[model samples]
Target: MRPFSKSLAVQIFVGTIQRLPQSARPSGIYKTRVNMPVYLNINGFEGDQQADLRVHGGPDKAVQLYPVAHYAALIKRFPELLGKLAPGAIGENISCPDLNEQEVHIGDLWQLGEALLQITQPRSPCSKIDEKLDCKGVAAYIAQSSKTGWYFRVLEPGMVTAENRLVLVESGNEHYRLCSILSLMQQNESAAIGALQRCLMAPGIADNLRLKIEQKIVHLNRASTGTP
Candidate 1:
């Protein structure tokens, strides 16, 4: 609308990463992830091999990143960024919760008026998040849930913020979104591959996304569809 509003005074940042006790990567059908530091960009993006996977909070494993009030008490530690970042950053977030508990669970899908994205997995605990928190055992709990991280694949890449309206814009078909296919991959390889293959068919989905989906698909078979 504003011919790309990167100049619209949009504010964004890297939030805290919750770490856990050291643990080995779990034995799983998909990728192997070890317990480590996982970072959050306040507006919901968590760092991952994929582009920023949007989420609701820190892994409910140990530290919860939502409920802004919890984070507000912690924000005091960052005085220089007091007003600049949102002296009330956490407060503003808790006042209006975005994705609900059930929606965050694996296999759930959501639609925000900003864009029609679908969450596929949880933000797995990474070593970087552990370093930021200076804590242990954080990553283990995350893997227990099968390293499921919250992911919001962009139906449309649009701007976001801590002060967003936080609304549910659409209710999705249980099968069409990525949530339905992700869990199935562990048990039903053919079906999972079929579903993921369809997702990669979307118009603007990136090459990275295509490759990740193809990799998961290839684990069952042997060939990749997209070239990284």
Candidate 2:
């Protein structure tokens, strides 16, 4: 992997619950850029909130970082989303350039201003994304491309501002890059079993993700053996 810059400039975003006219369920996907400093805690930014706590906010998914580069590619493929999909449109808390899933490992740690953040897992795209963007298959495309951004768990909470940049303080399992993990997930059990086994051994993996992988392995084993 190539060396990352000492500090990568970042943009911070946050949102509250909002109910779109077309959807009955409220969502926090409509985020706006925060120009001032905000407190970062174990749960998330001070002003940030998710409509569904069951799957969105938690210690394991305190922050979401999306690459700005993705916007251009997305718009190119989905011209209809030209003005609809942009930075902060996908509920990403941190928007940074020159960084994507390919460059980040599962457990990489970074220092953002006064807070320490560790990557736990890739952000699982949900149907809410399609509703929010008013474009079908967008979420599925993100998953297939492995361009889906990853999540960060705050290791040390503190005040942070858009002026602050991300600095890599530590690296995690190189073999378990986010892109590779997502790719493995898209594969069948027979094709992904070996890599899945190795991924579970990686340090700093989210508890929920580990459980999911373990469960998948169990299901795969049963299927392979022709057992119900």
Candidate 3:
């Protein structure tokens, strides 16, 4: 594992569970920027809540980090969303400049303030994004573009704040870049089977994500052999 030489500033955000007025479904996507320090535990930051534990807010998906650069690209793609979308628009807990899917790898570990965090997997964009942004196809656009951010699991809990900087302590497999993993996930052909297998073996990978990858490989193998 290699150490990241430079540290990047972190902007923190957190939100509580709220019911969407349109769908009545509970969501934690509407985050507010935090100027003060907040405690981060194995589950997540204090005051942050996930409506549905089945899909969000666990040890594996404790914190979500989105790149600030992607917001510019998104606005360029959808000019109408110029004012609607920004750093915390996507429900990310952290926004770091120049740190997108391509720059990070699965299983990478970083120190934020006094806490330790490990990159687990790329966040899967859902319909909630469309609802939150009040625009259709935003979720699909993020998924297709592979601009979807990634999640982090807390390895050592401590207080963190926007003033903190994310310093890489340990690097994950360079072969399993978050962008490549997200791309491979969208490809179901036999050609992607091998790559998917290797991604599953990456250290610090989220259990739920690993299970999904394993299932994809099984499906691909079955398709190639005409077993179904």
Candidate 4:
């Protein structure tokens, strides 16, 4: 088995929520970065929200949670020592407990121990990061390189405080990691279709993601396979 990475905590600030559009948002969550325990989960996405946890604090943005960075300037100086196989597939010296279920695939969701949360999409780097660092397009660099962060879909609504054990529950298709599958999907439509089909068969995949996959399948089949 591959060695697991370590998990880190970052405190969230409450002021950031003011920037979000109010909808499906629970009032009282903080916006500042706070130290919260992020663990590996079987959902194929890192930093899963627990079923018994209500997002106590996060940006009022659509997905309320803090996104950790995969890139660290500290390791860039020693890329040769890092043995970066694919630049950003996994960060150098990755230290987090985010598990991708048994297999880790796209459109996968997992329940925290018993019932906690549903990790869905990864936190792709955005322009907002550029301002944070005063560097234009830094976020784009991390995203293009595949160091995109992760997020969770709230389930089993409860409070998520610091020191949460963040149990890993297996749900959806635990076969292919989302990043790997996405890479394949972009190249070979046939393989992408197969992967999407596999994801379709997984238990508890979110309908939105599934629909997106299906749409891609339809478009790709027509473009690459010449669907009749």
Candidate 5:
């Protein structure tokens, strides 16, 4: 398939450290941001670090992206979040316009600066976001709103700045959009069997996510046939 006609990078952020909350125990949340002109490799930004490696910062999740457009609406919903939430607040490395869950598909390849990237999967919104916001259910809100941004796997590593434009050089797995996959994963209903199956076969999908889909397919099949 052809690349999306346009994709723009509004800001670039790299994590500095995982910060513990002011009046709470260690949160393991990377709440700091780094300067631009950062190095991006298969592992992730060179200076960045994720407190929990089990759920973040791997080859399949080299880069985290959030749509800049989602910020305004989110701020309106939670006024307290107006100043607290900004680019990189949710652990995203790149903030972009025009790239949302609906339009970006798994396996889509992009050219950014001198590097190549492939859309791997949607970022599974976690409880840490709520902890960061000091408001419960914010993570669920992100999921329900479908504003949860997606992740990118580095195909070729290079330096990237905030102003570097994102060019979609290749499109992958048009059979499933990132939002649809996130919906299916969240709902896990038998109605999404076809989508789940396609996701399992889709190239560049994370192994853990693929396994989850496989399990869901088995569960759905057993339920449909009333098997034990």
Candidate 6:
């Protein structure tokens, strides 16, 4: 067991839903940086709001985390987007330097400050983030690039701060890596069905994601059977 200690939660954040002048829809995508202490509950950060409950903020998808390094890489690729792509640009509840899809695995448990957290699944990026950055195709690019972040469920709700670290106490099922799962879904749904089913049965998978995989399985079944 290699030490899984890393600087997780480099920046804590929360946001309320607001209507942007450019878009007709309301979104909580614009997160505010939190320098002080905050509460992490079973649902999510106390002040954070999820505009679309259908897709986000459930018990299993309570905390969203993104890698700080990914933002820098994106900036290097698209220099024009330097300003728009900040710490909380993608509506993450935590901005971490090493808490990326490549490092973390589904069901990985950690001691995050006073709260116990578990990795659930890779984040499914939406078009709202693309619009937030005033850039088209960003969401698709994120999916294709496999830099989309991961989600965590709060097992032990408690107060946490930006200064806290995430010390991995145990590794989950190593068969499923966030990036690998996402890549499989994108490239071949048939190939991903088995993994998705396993994830659905896994203890740590988010409910929303389980529902999604179930729906995909149905669609694939119909496609294969030629059931129009």
Q: Rate the local accuracy (lDDT) of all candidates.
A: 0.36, 0.87, 0.90, 0.41, 0.79, 0.79
Put down candidate 2 lDDT per residue, 60-124, tens digits, no spaces: 99999999998888888789998787789888999998789888898888999899998999988
Most accurate candidate by TM-score: 3
Clashing pairs in 2: none
Question: What is the C-alpha lDDT profile of model 6 across 1-228, one tens digit per residue?
Answer: 334545444788899998754676889888999878898899988899988888778898899888888888777766779888888988998888766787777788888778999888788789887778777778887778888898899999999877887778777665666766676566444666776677666668776667767887777767777888
Question: Which lDDT value does model 4 have at 178?
Answer: 59
Worst 10 residues of 5 by lDDT: 22-31
Q: Which residue pairs collide, candidate 6?
A: none
1 or 2, greater by lDDT = 2
Candidates 1 and 3 compared: the better one by TM-score is: 3
Ranking by TM-score: 3, 2, 5, 6, 4, 1
The alpha-carbon lDDT assigned to residue 23 of candidate 4 equals 35
In model 6, which regions exceed 4 Å deviation?
1-9, 189-193, 218-228
TM-score of each: 0.41, 0.93, 0.96, 0.55, 0.89, 0.87
Better by lDDT, candidate 3 or 1: 3
All candidates in order of lDDT, best leading: 3, 2, 6, 5, 4, 1
**TM-score for model 3?**
0.96
| Model 4: CA > 4 A from native | 1-15, 18-31, 35-69, 73-115, 226-228
In model 1, how large is the Cα lDDT of residue 151?
44
Ten contiguous residues minimizing lDDT sum, candidate 4: 85-94
Model 5, 39-116: lDDT tens per residue? Answer: 889988778777668887889988888998888878878888877887777878878877788888888888888889
lDDT of 4: 0.41
What lDDT would candidate 6 get against the real structure? Answer: 0.79
Candidate 1 residues 1-228, lDDT tens each? 011111111122233323223443221111112133323332233432222234233222111223223233333543433443331232111122233223333222233324334443333445433332344443453344332333444444344444443344443443334334345444434556676766655443334445666778777555343334
Q: Which candidate ranks first by lDDT, i.e. highest?
A: 3
- Give the distance in Å from residue 89's predicted Cα in candidate 6 to where it truly belongs: 1.3
